[model samples]
Target chain A: MNHRVLLLALLLLALPSWAVIETYQFDTDLQRQRYNAFIEELRCPKCQNQNLSGSDSAISQDLRRQLHAMIMAGKSDIEITQYMVDRYGDFILYRPRFNAATAVLWLLPVGLLLGGLAIWALMASRRTRRVPIQPLDDHDRAALDSLLSDEEKPSERSGGNS
Target chain B: MSRIKLFLPLIIFLVLVAIFFGVQRRVQTGDYSPTALPSALLNKPFPEFSLPTLQGESLSRAELPKQWLLVNVWATWCPTCHYEHPFLVELAERGVPILGVDYKDRREPALKWLAEKGDPYFATVFDEQGTLGLDLGVTGAPETYLVDAEGIVRFRYQGALDQKVWDEQFAPMLSSLEEASP
Candidate 1:
């Protein structure tokens, strides 16, 4: 048990060194945060699914280096994003721009949810509005009294015999 | 009204299904290849840069011909460039002036390749560091740009250029630009 615990500890200790080390330097914490956010926002062109920070492809590495250079040179986020978009098209952005081509993609989900809710509410209201019980009429009251009397006379005769 | 309401979701679903198949069919038969990325530099002036030719001559945008030209990005390491090289040689021989941007390649091997295969470019600009290539929005080698007389970029095609690609993508654009030219 002790050996197993030591082995696990050693493995955990070696894990950090095995990870890929990023060499980018930021002057301030805010700059570093912005860099992280920017990379997370941008998709890696070569990898398709991974973001720039997560991709280990050569193009992604080059882009990261370029991003660092631009950030150090005081380029704004918009300028950096625009630079990438110009080269790679709008596909590089995780948050696509609102345009005619992508308007349906952005609006469809909300429209679907609203439509579903409307249908659900309509169904619920229809279910609640069941036909009300009508008041007993004079004819219905007379028929009910006669039925009760007939049942009571049979029971009375049986009770007297008992 | 309720009947229509009940069928509303089905109607939306059918419409979505139609759109999906339509897009799928369009993609399967589309003219644009998946690897071909649309350049934002279209209709804009070519990025300015001064580069040294492989032959030790300094070349710049001002030195380019005041007529239509093709700027082809190629490298020694790109295999597709080899396939497109002979076509370029043919175009060059037929009096088409092509400016070759040797992208991210060493000077010696590029010179050797040119010597062995015969040079197809009017002037081959050395972009060993790929700085000018980055400025021009070059994602990879074998990307070609068609520039008009005013140094304006008219069309960009990414991938190996051949007779079919030239006929389909570049030739039409070139003729239209020529027609529009005074």
Candidate 2:
């Protein structure tokens, strides 16, 4: 029984060393998810087809890590994305920022909407004020009616002519 | 009538001109920027994943040495993956160690593809669950990663590899990494 106690004490002495705590900079789940969202929204400029967060490309991974670090360093999502934009171009954004370089991108749908409205207005106005075609006079109408009757009288006249 | 009708074509021409300018402006905005993105995970440590080979043996991250190694995450289902296969095969022949992670693929199809086409990897990791892919930030297949031997990612290339990219970007980076390593 004494020998068993000594063995148990030795085991207990070793147990404390086995338990280790690892601390990550992104301690909160919210911060980590935010970082993920930010990366997901950004485009991988190198691979134009992929978003930076979704791409496992080394560059993307690096960018994610960089963003994570930046978050830990207390940088906001806008700041991080802008930093990438400044280094790369507007291509880094899956949804690009509105500036001189990308103003048209942002305003295109609005422009299309306004242009459509203008066209609709123009068409409505044009239709409302259309130049009406005048009806034929009595003499012309009588001639047209007679021509129509003459054309339909072909079978009736065949027997008479014979 | 002659004076008024003379300006009809001019009015039409101005309208056409306005439409043309609007379209041009739209085009400029819709066009995505042609600039390449730098690797986002630069200087960040890689995620942990243990992938088994087709031969059924698992490989760990520790197996890869401390140098610039390209990790190709792909699957047979990915059409773009096939497009980049030949480029990878050629790179493999040139002594580039391609670490392939077969993402969410069946063992048989992957084996068949590797058998029909020439194998291009020094070592392959089978990620059937795609958990590793998520950890690596992969959205789809046919993505490539450039990781230093320390397992820190250096660069990333998305989509398929073309000759021009192989020549311009990867070749130079490969040479430099080789020179920098022991």
Q: What share of the true interface contacts does each candidate keep?
A: 0.36, 0.05
For candidate 1, lDDT tens digit of each residue in A54-118? 88765677788888999999999989988988767677789988888678989999999999999
Q: What does candidate 2's lDDT look like per residue over B26-59, in tens digits? A: 6566332234344446567777667788769988
TM-score of chain B of each: 0.86, 0.76
| Candidate 2 lDDT tens digits, A24-75 | 3687888878876886788774475888655666556656766777888888
Q: Candidate 2: deviation at residue A7, Å?
A: 79
Q: TM-score for chain A of every candidate model? A: 0.71, 0.60
Q: DockQ numbers for every candidate?
A: 0.32, 0.04
Number of clashing pairs, model 2? 17
| Ten contiguous residues with the weakest lDDT in model 2 chain B | B30-39
RMSD of each: 6.7, 19.6
lDDT, candidate 1, B1-182, per-residue tens: 97998999999999999998887786676564555667768888998889999999999989999999999999999999999999999999988889999998999999999999989999999998887777777877889999999999889888888887788888899889879996
Q: Can you tell me the CAPRI class of model 2?
A: incorrect
**Number of colliding residue pairs in model 1:** 0
Q: What DockQ class does candidate 1 belong to?
A: acceptable
